[model samples]
Target: MSIDAFAATSLPVRVGVQIAPQHALYPKIREAVQEVEDLGVDVLFNWDHFFPLHGEPDGLHFEAWSLLAAWAEQTSRIELGPLVNCNTYRNPNLQADIARTIDHISGGRLIFGTGSGWFQRDYDEYGYEFGTAGQRLDALARDLPIIRDRWTKLNPAPVRDIPILIGGGGEKKTLRIVAEHASIWHSFSNTETLERKLGILAGHADAVGRDVREIEISTGVELDFSEGLLEAQHALGVRLFTVGLSGPDYDMAPVRRLLAWRDAANA
Candidate 1:
């Protein structure tokens, strides 16, 4: 196993596990955080969705930021944040303040992962207009800088400069935003898609006069990365790997294996 995995970098490659808060009781949701932190996971992420994404779509669910605040106070050693906050749900300035407060609550370990949201139900239910993907991405592009500038200007300020994580892999618009703004860019494509998207992002970085390497590449690990896949992604500068699990007695056998992969890669 790579000894340090995500934590191998000077800035730490960082492994993230997202706990889906839908379809689970509060206690189960509560214990999931304790479990991952105990397992030495680097980051604990929660999605900013109101309802279940899968497995009985209309099942019981909880709010996103409230859960995050609970997680922030509950854990002491792990970094915690939304895998990507839905920019449509909250105003950018308000989102910045919420993140800033959580940053202090977590004692300087919050990563502000955000994206142009896609879920129509969330927008309709919350009275946020469900716009086109291009429209939403455009709004996200606008909000990201506003949020960052607000972070710098917020009273008492964030404990540290919160790392900006721009989620989504839209080659034309989203990747350009990643090159311009994100400290971490989370994508859910297979190795092939990632390669193509990274090429596009590199072009965006060049156009923006930014180093592509400054932004970390992250992908989900529902299955192991093949040697060829790993080598290819690594060659393209992809480092951080994430595995997502949902609540109420969910198994973590996969996470243990991924953790070992991380250790081996860094060994």
Candidate 2:
């Protein structure tokens, strides 16, 4: 669950950008963030990791939520959050408290993106336990409800009811948690995998007495397959598609094309 960035829907089209916090200098990433929002992307995302996930392992990086606290204040229109934060990094109550603060920082434009812990490097390097996937997701399952409960009880409350975005495509556990807790569910699977997973997700939704449509389906665009994939996912009831690009030099050419397709598709 090392999502620091995600794409979101806005009006006739939805788009997003992620400025990899660990991979870039803060000022440059900050500038890129401002640029991304200026490009009219709906949501701005960042990942939660102590070290760089790609490129050099020992490259420079920054903490996830703190930068989000800054992002909350830095931009005015774009909704922002960690693409997906690791649930194991912070206690549920503390995470809720932090989210509440960032919620205010963005004047209620924050999306609380979270997921069951993954990325063993982040855990081990940070001195947190690298437990079994099931155990961590179980902690995540327990934690999400508590965070929501605490949100209801907190003073001043969240700036608004911050929307929750949960990532992962697991069957027995992860999707079940999404059915129970997520407002937006991000997936790495392409159309075929997404098509199959949708049924499983629906079963979980039905078991929990929840409507499948209540949780938004989200997928990614990697340039070559983006146009067709976005359309296919949209046909499968996914309106939110994210195109991820990371760098020393952030280029947004493909994002422009996807937005064009989205408008055409919805038209």
Candidate 3:
């Protein structure tokens, strides 16, 4: 898989910021969201988790969907959603309705990123079943179609065909589901891993009769903006780069650098 292989599908580079909702107050989180949106990032994301993923286990954290609804109203330009909503948290139809509602609220700026539920602690604490990885992925496969169908049956349809971003790189099931349902595929992969996964994903897409290049590739970034690293990813068809900022301080410097990189790359 080479960059030229995806050349016919040239995608504009996009930068996103994930504002982690743990260990922070609601007001502070709100302020961070506003600041990032103002900073001109292309997308804004918050993770779906019951508790903090890092640092203190009992840190102050907020729910994902509810905060997304709030963010829909809070920002106007950036597309918003959970970085990857847990599929098992709510009924698929209900998730669809909720996503549709938020899509309407945001006037069509929603990116419905979802995944097979993980994090045993979130399941244990919230009373949802903690199944095996395969089981969870099976559930995700079953529900995605239902979610899409429910979107059609809603009283008021979504303002736009809500873009579905499936997060994960499990080559067997996850990539196949992404082939069938996703508009974007989000993952954390280095250059070699990304190239291999993209090749696997393309095989899956072929099996399902889809063009893999149609799916946008997204990944996270660190503070140190390595030109060589990003260039390698760009060559392998990744266009959407995201950087996550944790609570308390929600630093914007790295985000600014990524934004600048995005502008330069797309220039």
* lDDT tens digits, residue span 1-267, model 3: 333455445889999999999999999999999999998999999999999999999999999999999999999999999989999999999999999999999999999999997899999988999989999999999999999999989989999999999999999999999999999999999888988888888888888998777899898878776989998888777889999999888989998888888899999
Return the lDDT, model 1, position 220: 71
lDDT of 2 at 7: 17
| Better-scoring candidate (lDDT), 1 or 2 | 1
Model 1 residue 80 lDDT score: 87
Locate the minimum summed-lDDT window of 10 residues in model 1. Answer: 1-10
**For model 2, what is the C-alpha lDDT against the true structure?**
0.81
Error of 3 at 56 (Å): 0.7
Best by lDDT: 3
TM-score: which candidate is best?
3
Query: Runs in model 3 with CA error above 4 Å?
Result: 1-4
lDDT of 2 by residue, 1-267 (tens): 011111133324467666677666878888888887887788888888888888888888888898998888899999998888999999999999999999987888999999987888888778999889999989999999899999999998998888999999889999999989998888888778987788888888888888665667777667565466676677676767677766666677876777677667767
Candidate 2, residue 167: the lDDT equals 90
lDDT of 3: 0.91
Off by over 4 Å in 2: 1-13
At residue 247, give the lDDT of candidate 1.
Answer: 59
